[model samples]
Target: MKRRHFLQLTGATLAAVSLVQTARAAQPPATDAKAFRAMRKYANLSFGRIAYVDRGTGDAALFLHGAPLNSFQWRGAIDLLSPYRRCIAPDFMGLGYSEVPEHQALDARAQLEMLVALLDSLGIRAVDIVASDSGGAVAQLFVAHYPKRVRTLLLTNCDVEPNSPPPGIKPILDMARAGTLADMTAEWLTDRAKARATFGAAVFVNPAQLTDEIIDYYVQPLVSSPLRRSQYERYHLALTPNPLAGIESRLAHSTVPVRIVWGGSDTLFPQTDAAYLDRIFPRSQGVHVIPEAKLFFQEEYPSVIAAEARRVWGMR
Candidate 1:
């Protein structure tokens, strides 16, 4: 069957499951809402009323998600990181439950501004940043512009330079500009099998772990009309001049320690880019390559990634 048809069928299947649940209970469970509330209280910041989850209390550790995802991406890692430090994960503007401002620039600079506003609102003077994929680009810009706020940097599966994007991503950007993003989202984001395959292609050490529930969770928001457009815009912004275009120059002069964790099997951004990042951030102390993992290392191997975070933070 065509990918679009498959997705439509899958949506029907999910709807059936919801109906079954409703028949069993008069009201839906509040587990997800309650969990979201916990995250919100920990990372409550001002740019918008972002949904987040916070765990533990001590030094701050901020987890940033990539395009099309929210704090939900860190669901597996949050519990593990919370015991060691205050883990703050926020849904960036235009993603998750965060306010999707219609007039917002949606560029790298605008994202950095929101980050700064968020930190200032929360009165968080400093933090250790852990970023993946597009989030890494945002974190790089944050570190470059506000070095004082960052104590350590952890970059994973990200391209630091504007010219270094992986092979096919540029073409996807071109397609988005040509008004093909909606179709692409329908193919890649909404389809359950495709979504599972894409996530597996990126970061599954064990493909068996890509469960139906997980795939449903990832694609659920995209089912909404506005959320899908917000996600598409994020990809469009990434194709332009990155906010961290001159990141090497900034990192070269930065005093904060840096570390890189890469999934050797990452099909999006290859492991070769890790060396380029290490060269740029000379003070980088370690580079770990998780052999079986893919781009989304935290999801595939949260325990390992959490342990690495603790080690990087000197909590281990």
Candidate 2:
């Protein structure tokens, strides 16, 4: 049998992690590469121009993506939930098509400020948020710093107060500090098979999901120039000093409804974080743990994200 989808409070954390792994078919979900490209628009904020997709209309739902990834990660969720909310997915500066000054500070705090500026540019007052990976760290900071601007939060596999930048990421961080991560990934451009293999092990549950087109879409711009490569390295280095530190009290005090949908099998973030997140936030709905999903499972399981998001927002 396939993994039975489940959601429960932090109380049943152990049982939830013990659930059987899901069977993931190998086909990458069909993404309209052309449509996503055509829809891209830039918001000229104080920092720089941020590339984002603003779709549908209603209360806004801001989707924040992870490191080594950009707004493109949320395409599926936007596709599924846009009709119910104004889905806004922005590529963090230094990632995706977003352009920032070469001297821009690339850190969670910087990202939080950029978000404020982005929302200001759009004349938005508040947002319902869905964030993954490093983006989750930024989301937490956003809540602590600007609690009034958020309505609800949905977090996928990512950093938490106690486990920010999970230990497994050390190697990548080391590579980034050595100024070699971008160069290492640049090889993916010539070796699509290698790209799929690396991402399959790290992010995707199904290797076949990474097609050549997806590889090109994700990697080309990342290493297209020396500046982008430097920014890529800087992006990873900014996670240090534990950005989520000192915000535990603020997060604990927040009234924003929070939900954690984590990938139990993700090597970078431990399964316990789902419970930690559940325990930290007073308004936590629960933690939904997918045993077989990897770090970037939102790309693999957008429906799960959409359902949890709708549930949080009370969408029909």
Candidate maximizing TM-score = 2
Clashes in candidate 1: how many?
6
lDDT, each prediction: 0.66, 0.84
Q: Which segments of model 1 are wrong by more than 4 Å? A: 1-47, 162-164, 186-190, 227-231
Q: Which stretches of candidate 2 lie over 4 Å from their true place?
A: 1-30
RMSD to native for every prediction?
12.7, 4.5
lDDT by residue for model 1 over 118-232, one digit each (tens)?
A: 7677668899998887788788888888999999887888766844455646666776677665566556544667756664555666655666655555445543576556555
Give the per-residue lDDT of model 2 (tens digit) for 4-72: 213345343444333212223332353477789889999988788889999999999999999788888
Record all residue pairs in model 2 with backbone atoms less than 3 Å apart, i.e. clashing.
none
Deviation from native of the Cα of residue 35 in model 2, angstroms: 1.1
